[model samples]
Target: MQLEKDSKLELNDRSRQIGDVITDVESKVRKKYETHFQEQEDKIAELQRQLNLVSARSRRPKRGRKGKEV
Candidate 1:
């Protein structure tokens, strides 16, 4: 009976260790993905800004077109 109890304790300890390792790996992966997503978001924002600049320029009438009658 004592040997069985000892084996059970060892098994429980190993399980706890594995669980801790899994949790740590999960945390690292989540952080990495968050960083990746943030970088992508920043790139998208930059592209949007550039698009807005181009759009603003395109919407204005050119000086040459003003002298011509519609």
Candidate 2:
């Protein structure tokens, strides 16, 4: 009976350690993905800003010399 109890305790300890390691690895992966997503968001925002500038320029008239008298 005592031997069985000792075996159970050892198994529980090993299971707990395995769970802790898996949790740690999961946390790191989650953080890496979060950073990757943030970088993508920043890139998308920059592209949007550039697109707006191009559109604004296209909507404006040419400055100097279509030659219809000053």
TM-score of each: 0.76, 0.76
Alpha-carbon lDDT, every model: 0.79, 0.80
lDDT of 2 by residue, 1-70 (tens): 0123345567777677678778888999999999999999999999999999999998876665875534
Clashing pairs in 1: none
What local lDDT score does residue 55 receive in model 2, on the 0 to 100 scale?
98
Tens digits of per-residue lDDT for model 1 on 1-70? 0123345567777677678778888999999999999999999999999999999998876555657534
Q: Candidate 2, clashing residue pairs? A: none
Instruction: Tell me the spans in candidate 2 whose CA falls farther than 4 Å from its real position.
Output: 1-9, 65-70
Least accurate 10 contiguous residues by lDDT in model 2: 1-10
lDDT of 2 at 9: 65
Error of 1 at 62 (Å): 1.2
lDDT score, candidate 1, position 60: 76
Q: How far off is residue 23 in model 2, in Å? A: 0.4
